[model samples]
Target: MRKQQRIKKNEDFQQVFKHGTSFANRQFVVYIYPKKNQTELRLGLSVSKKLGNAVKRNEIKRYVRQAIFELQSELKANVDYVIIARAGATDLNFHETKKSLQHILRIAKCLPKVRNEVK
Candidate 1:
């Protein structure tokens, strides 16, 4: 993700936290706040220090960033998404991290629903 596509300011984070609707699964909590007339979506990630040391935390953030990059096309524009990592997230590998993020985004209605069709 580019720097412009990230939610970097403390005020922006607080605004989203205060006004956004939240959804969660076992691994992540996602907060969504819609912005009018905006064409891009911004992402913010939070992994607590309690989860591990700096290396572990940075690894988790990397996984989350990569997952979001892959899933960007499926996500809604005109919104800010704040994702909080749960303790369970520390044990996941990259693929598992992507899956967990997908799950939470689906719950938050950020991703379009997939239809099951037998060909």
Candidate 2:
């Protein structure tokens, strides 16, 4: 993700946490807040030191970012999302992390609505 698209400020994460709705699972917690009139989605990631050492934390963050990048087109626009990693997240593989993240996002309604094909 680009710098502009990522929420890097402490205040931004707090704002989202203060005003956003969240959904939690065993591996992650997803917080979301919609920005009115905006056209792009912004993402923030949080993985605390208690979860692991720097290397492990960065790996988890990478997994989450990759999942977001893969699903970028399906994400809702003008929304700010904060994904908080729980302890169990460190033990998950890439596919498991992606699946857990998707489940969290789906519960939080951050992903775009699915459409059925008409053939």
Candidate 3:
């Protein structure tokens, strides 16, 4: 995801959480909000302190980032997505994380509609 497309302000997270819809899988709790910019999608990742130590938190965030990066193009445009990491994420292997991410995306209709879009 591009730097410009990352949701940085705490207010943005608050707004998204208050107004957007949410979907969850074993690893991630995804909140998505529609926006005016049809060509941009903002992403916010939250790995709570309760989940683990700093190393574990960062590691889980890295895994989530990798999953989102791979599906950047397929992700719907003009949406603000906040991904909250669950405790389950810390123990998941790469393939398991990938599958969990995909599962939530599919449920949320956030995955690209075309098969080829999900790379």
**Model 1 TM-score, 2 decimals:** 0.95
lDDT of 3 by residue, 1-119 (tens): 57887889999999999999999877789999998855778889999999989998888877877888888888887899999988889899767787798889889988744466556
lDDT of 1: 0.93
Which regions in candidate 3 have their CA more than 4 angstroms from the true location? Answer: 112-119
Candidate 2's C-alpha runs over 4 A off are 112-119
Q: Write the per-residue lDDT of candidate 1 for residues 7-58, one digit (tens) a residue.
A: 9899999999999999988889999999998899999999999999999999
RMSD of each: 1.0, 2.4, 3.5
Best by lDDT: 1
lDDT (Cα) of model 2: 0.90
Q: List the candidate numbers ranked by lDDT, top first.
A: 1, 2, 3
Which of 1 and 3 is the better model by lDDT?
A: 1
Candidate 2's residue-wise lDDT over 1-119, tens digit each?
A: 77788999999999999999989999999999999987888999999999989999999999999999888988988999899999999999999998898888877776655679899
- What is the TM-score of each predicted model, taking all chains together? 0.95, 0.91, 0.88
lDDT of 1 at 35: 98
